[model samples]
Target: MAASPSRRDRTLSAHHRKKQPEQVRRALLDCAAQIAAEQGASAITIQAVAERAGVTKGGLLHHFDSKQALLAAVFEDLLDKMDQEIDRTLADDPASRGRFTRAYVRACFSDRLLGDRSLWGALSVAIVSEPALRALWSAWLDGRMARHAETDGDQRLVAVRLAADGVWLADMMEKDGGLKRYPQDFEVVLLAMAEGGN
Candidate 1:
């Protein structure tokens, strides 16, 4: 009383059998992220990703249902990595107060978020252009903010975080790396503010 597998399902099963599903999925995601970082998100078609990943279109499809889903996965992967980086930063700090805010400042200034050549900078365009991607980013940020409210809920810390955001936005908008013009102590100042220092 069960229905037979469709041709597409059978093909996907074959592809899964040939390649480790987790490995193939990771490869596809990496390839897609690389393409987006190198050529912009507009170049991330199923064909391009499959070719870049050295997998067939069916194989890529077996991992991602569509180009949008693949893109979402790529963004999610980046977010997860960023989350880990923040945790690593926080782990270095002994103080609990403003720890999350300091990590946010550090991340905003990180090379990964500052230059157009960085993956985050490259994906910034896609995030602005894609509504779904934007929503995902917003949701992730909101969750992080909520999770850190206990330690970083002070209004002064919030302002410092917003200033860090401004710094990042200015860097993202500038082509010649204008953020470097600020005094070398800019981040130090921000970190002090993050801890409610004068």
Candidate 2:
């Protein structure tokens, strides 16, 4: 019989084995996102994503059955990532409890700064034009905002939330030389609103 594998070999075997499928899935998603970033959402289809991912169409179908499913996956993945980021940001705050409002606002700004909004923004045209995608986001936001009702349902808090989203949206949709003016202390202003200092 062959000699038993060494610990190093076994460890490498397990690590690579575990990572393979997840890496493939991540690669597929990245390809789909790149398509959305470079070509717009309408360009994302099974064949297109497969080609971008350097996988067979059958491989793409193994991950997503249809374009609708693919788009849903993209939205769900992106939202899930943002939710995790919000949770982490909240945990790092000095006053964690009852600070969901501050955490939520900070998270959106962080997303604008260090996140994937540009790719998602490129897909905004598709999101706006596609009634189904619009409904998907609408329902998701409705449920999410309901959960953060204390922050989003109240008038004062809602104003800040909407204002942040509006700014981010404007930034996303802006074309060169369209507008350059923004409140210099915007995040500071948002923090004040969130902290009831305004």
Candidate 3:
């Protein structure tokens, strides 16, 4: 039996409504990131984010109570996704220190991460505006670096860590010209260092 048009429409509409919350949340975050990327994090107000996301202010507030909370969520989201991608990248060669360093660098520079500069900008502002948030971010990076050091040792890991930070900073600042020469050259040097080159 063929389904009536009204019934088919209702079924699809119900499915859409069921999926709307997640979609709205994603939209809100995307909009917030755009605002942060375009005008810096200080410009990301709830109203502005809502407008950018094509949602009402009430709808935005329904998902996030305040700007601080939203910023926290954004940072958390970026970190969590990065962690997952790194984990997946390292899964096959867990014991290869060189592979781990390469995977880490690739993840940092990947299109997925680079495309979310707003999240980076927001995190930067959060660090200055909220000391605790900064501390947490520091702790997270320190722990990751310590793990890298444990695996790759002080010398190689130090260079890798510094390079990672430099790459991220250059990208966030849109200083591509200044950083253009480093990606290939730095990776070669870093890989050699990781492999105990002189």
Specify the highest-TM-score model's number.
1
RMSD of 3: 6.2
Stretches of candidate 2 above 4 Å error? 1-23, 96-98, 111-117, 176-179, 183-185
Candidate 3: which pairs clash? Answer: none
Query: Would you list the clashing residue pairs of candidate 2?
Result: none
**What TM-score should be assigned to candidate 3?**
0.67
lDDT of 3 by residue, 89-186 (tens): 77866456655566676665565234445456445655667865776678877777677655655566667757876766665555454356455456
Determine the backbone clash count of candidate 2.
0
Worst 10 residues of 3 by lDDT: 112-121
Model 2 poorest ten-residue lDDT run = 175-184
Candidate-wise lDDT, in order: 0.82, 0.69, 0.68
lDDT of 1 by residue, 1-198 (tens): 999999798777765675588998999999998888788788899999998887789878988999999999999999999899999999998888899999988877776333556777777777878898999999998999899888898889889988887776665566346456544358888998877422
Model 2, CA-based lDDT: 0.69
Q: Could you estimate the TM-score for every candidate?
A: 0.83, 0.73, 0.67
Candidate with more favorable, higher lDDT: 1 or 3:
1
lDDT of 3 at 125: 50
TM-score of 1: 0.83
Whole-structure CA lDDT of model 3: 0.68
Q: Which stretches of candidate 1 lie over 4 Å from their true place?
A: 1-17, 112-114, 180-185, 196-198
